[model samples]
Target chain A: MAERVLVKGTEAIGEAAIRAGCRLFFGYPITPQNELPEYMSKRMPEVGGTFLQTESEVATINMVYGAACTGTRVMTSTSSPGFSLMQEGISYMACAQLPAVLVNVVRGGPGLGDIQPSQGDYWQATKGGGHGDYKLIVLAPSTVQEAVDLTVLAFDLADKYRTPVVIIADGVIGQMMEPVTFPEFRNLNTLPKHDDWALTGANGREKHIVVSFDIDPHVLEKMNLEIVEKLRKIEANEKRWEEYKLEDAEIVITAFGTVGRIAKSVVEQARKEGIKAGLFRPITLWPFPYERLEEISKGKKLILDVEMNMGQMLEDVKLAVKDHARIEFYGRMGGVVPTPDEIFEALKKFLNV
Target chain B: MLMGQILSLAGMFEGKHVTWMPSYGPEMRGGTANCTVVVSDEEVASPVTSQAEVIVAMNIPSLLKFEKAVTPGGYLFINQSVVDREPTRIDINIVKVPCNDIADALGNLKVANMVMLGAVVEKTKVVSLDSIFMALEKKLTGGKASLIEVNKEAIKKGMEAAK
Candidate 1:
């Protein structure tokens, strides 16, 4: 058995990426997620990988784009504002069908907000952030161990679908240290070959061109249709979620990322007080587990959506439950992490207990 | 921060779930820096807690800030060497340790955190002393390895004092 070691979440994600056969990392320094690039810088050299601190987030994303075109595993990580800067690059990569892993250790948003944990980027990550019609497969992890697991999975998903995959974690998951046992390093020689679409030197064969745009409107429409088809396949297969103490639950709490795990504690607390509360955490934000949530909310009295932002995922929860369950929202905006006590109080007030 | 880290590591070594979350940014540079450590037998849900099972206050500001955060029957270990005030809360168990004085007696003032950690471990049994020693040996490597004996001694003195 692999020995368990205590590791910070940022460093763990870097190690996981390396183990997943990702060799190239390009990112700019950002608050709350600077440790990720720092870890990459030190470990990349040891593993014969390349780690480059680009001049800006814009440059970082484009560097990822260029490296990914060669079919090599590439990744970049940043926080809220830095992620905002990479949206255009992300759209171009999605349209070009380039595979790359992106991590956003989200902090307070809407500009240069405080360097504290927040889930304000839910809409940006799930819905399209950049211009055009493209969707990035988004994975949200609640625990440090889950963060490590999802990072490795992000690379695989990115490569499998020929699209960029994002691991959206909050500052709490980025800064926290936890005990984790990592999987064995993937042999770089054994990784999947992407020779079909990779921009390897055309060795006296038909040249393969990778471009996101075409002057002909009809050709562009055809390319967009292909992307839409790919997204539909992903949506069908990639939906993921978790249910905790939901079998006998009357009031179900729906959350994602950091808020999800925090609400788990609230579930235990509410259960201790005979409140019959449960937790539903969506692990995949883009291909959201809407059907599973709808199935679970069938007999539940209420579905409470909790978040670090002002009711972003609540829209999806409302859509899933529809009129089957009464919906309520409890959120703490601008980087404030709601405590279990506070969330329990809200639940009690809702039940008038 | 080191104390909380060592405790979390020791818990991991004991095959328990543990998480350590530190307060980052400018507040960690010169201001009141703090970290939260949660050790549990089951999977830890939240890394942050409004009420802690135990709180080690190294100074007066921390005691004043977190004294009320202790659960009714929780343990509150205060560093008497720096904190001049007494905790007004009568619901929790308070173990006052002169961490700086003990470390000074051990020929270094840097092991004061370990001294307070010793008191918490002896009182709470959160992790075994053997595990703490192992974690300390693992953490204090290279140039920092030579100070392990003194730190161990400070911890032993803290345990004896807590008794």
Candidate 2:
């Protein structure tokens, strides 16, 4: 293992992005995620990278969109409300096929709410936040270490697909500190250059126009169909989830992000009590892994969806399980995270224990 | 902000896996601000946790808020200078120390958290005093270079009081 350092998730993710060869960052201050840009502000200049805090979230996203069109591994971070401000820019990036990382360290409520962790942005993240039929490659990391790893993956996945990637994490994961050993510093030296589409002064090559607006109806439909096809391929290959003791479990618990981490403890307690409870953690929130859930659902008595929001991801769990087993949901919202005891009580009610 | 960092460093320096979360509560200072640290032998799952085996409450609200969350037979080290409410839980052990007094005696009330930290290290034996001292030296020098000695003295006073 590499050398372990105790770091907050915000600090770790920023350093991981630096190691992942992301140099240019544009961000606006938002609660629960401000430390991220703080880290970048200190580290980016040291590494000859650009870290600019724009006047507003709208400016940050548009600046990121402009930087990303130049094939720069760029990023912008915000909480729910700030992310809402970036929706138009996000849609433009999706249309322009720009590779950039966006992090939504979600806080509570539908408006300017509390700075506590909440998973209410599930719909905004997974279901095209902007005004378009587009999807972002969203990865939900549970722990601080996973935040680092998934951030590295998010950048790579974004570049590989030539689209934006979202690291949809809650405030808990964003603010938490943990021992993390980053992978050997993958410097920008070893990465592939995106010179083909990159606007590098043409360099004696043909001119490139990075445009999201093609007025022809047929051409726009083709672009939308192409995005649909990419998402289809992604859904097929990138559905990632973890199953714990699903073989003998009669009740399967489904959760993601912080709720999933808390559910692991509940699963451990339920197992010790011989309750035959298991856990399924969705790592990729956008792909919404269901193939394994389908296999686990065959013999399970029930699927309990635990979320910090009120049954946001539960709809997907039902769509995946699809009448094979009864689906139940228990959630705590508005920044009130449930404890293991609370989850266990919910489990008992669902499992009739 | 640095409480969880020092604890996690001490834990990692002891060759253990540790995870922590610091509350950036909107209240900011003097308003129930605290952090949670979990040190274990193996990789810890999830940063979201409810219970603590040992809670070092430096303020009254923290003591009141986190006292019940401590496990049965767990330790609750409170700064008796600010917190006077006797913990209602009988199963847990409470070590109420005059943290502000000791830090003030040592000539720096700002090291009150360090005092409580030293007490936690001595009582829980979760991390060595040497590790914490090393962490303090690093943390102290990284920012305010002048308060290092008084904080160390505060920790020494705390170690003595913890006994």
Candidate 3:
């Protein structure tokens, strides 16, 4: 039966993780995402789960590293600044090929930006937030419901690939209240077997030292090549994006995360006004659906890149369309949202219809 | 605000294509606070509702802030005690109920949400009382059982008062 209740987005992530069988959560409090750890504290105990509000973002990421090493489904959340502080651990986790979920409930800025929603992290998330040659699976969910669903899928995908996964959202999606449903527990299950690559004492086997250090340049290149090959396999298997009204579209808008949701509304309103504008929302930011975008933009004249920052994703759109379409950009920076009417206006300017 | 509340509320829909535009910040604490929940059977690319077809104005700020966003032929429900603003929009249907009074009479201020829920139930009829009750039971328990009963009473009183 269909049910409706109002809930904030951060709490939804915590609840979904618990239902997805995540047993451990370690996070430091940051604006917008603080609700996630707060929710975990109240409910994780009920499920006999572990929820710890660590001293710092660094400690939290290390905690995630520890739990993930034990093969436990674990997660941590932080805003942009804290996420930046966590980049080192995230890089280490990526190098170790740990299965864990990290949520970046993004806020404004290149540094200590205000606690307002912003998508400036687009490049950081998709281009590997940390150094070295590694990629983390990134999922962008625009609504409270998707926050729940995506967090669940993040764990599954992380385990399936044995790589870290990121739930990249903005403060707007994190703070909003919407109706969401938890699927029946039967459909979700956490794996009980992860000791092969994990560090559960090596179980009387050779001591497993998980590190990214090999003193040989040739070995480093081989490791990088192996990681690239794995990423290619993931791209082929998991690239996902949603298309709306593209078959007959004259102008297509590409957006992700919170801005994508607003762009969707603008597309619908534009259509009502007899404009042939469509929406392409990327659910998976990394392993981007470039092929699908290329195929869909075949007959389009213009592709509008909409984001919360100053056109970070526009570069990707240009690369995908390969100049087949004239690309335009519209963005609101420092946590401002482009409303449907604003997006519609942009569409009119782009298509001139 | 609670985990169960966030989970059960998010569970009502089944899709990634919904918009959840929430107007929240430090400015919301002192004044009235509200959010937009857009549930489309089809894919929703953006989820910001400036005006609401139905305004569950728990306080006056919610009513004044969102009442103008209502579509021409929409409905507005305000809790009489908390909302002191006069109705300015003549096109939308206005349903006023003493929800706070009802919740107060029921002996709990927290039940105000339930009272608003009852008012929403009557106007939108989006979900049945039994289902909402089930959600409540699933959301609240143990020491919270008393709260559930009070909230249920508030719902009943608001529904009857609306009638």
**For every model in order, what is the number of clashing pairs?**
0, 0, 15
TM of each candidate vs. truth? 0.99, 0.96, 0.84
lDDT of 2 by residue, B24-50 (tens): 766565666777788889767655567
Instruction: Identify the candidate with maximal lDDT.
Output: 1
- In order, the Cα lDDT scores of the candidates are 0.92, 0.85, 0.79
True contacts kept of each: 0.75, 0.71, 0.54
Interface RMSD of each: 0.5, 1.7, 3.6
For residues A189-266, what per-residue lDDT tens digits would candidate 3 score against the true structure?
437557666677856898776666678999878877877888989999998787877878888989998888788778
Candidate 2 lDDT over A1-353, as tens digits, reads 68787778888899999889889889888888989999999999999999998999999999988888778789989999999999999999999888999999999988887888999999999989899799988899888888999999999999888889999888789888887888766767777578888776877899988878899999999988988898898888888887877778888999998888888888888888889888999999888887777877986788899998989999889888998998889999899888888999888887777
How well is each residue in B1-163 modelled by candidate 1, as lDDT tens digits? 9999999999988999999999898887799989999999999998889999899899888998999999999999999999998899999998999999999988899999989888888999999999999999999999999999998998898898899
Better of 1 and 3 by lDDT: 1
Number of the predicted model whose TM-score against the real structure is largest? 1
- What TM-score number comes out for model 2? 0.96
Residue A157's lDDT within candidate 2 is 91
| Position B91, candidate 1: lDDT | 91
In candidate 1, the residue pairs with backbone N, CA or C atoms under 3 Å apart (3 or more residues apart, or in different chains) clash, namely none
Give the better candidate number (2 or 3) by lDDT: 2
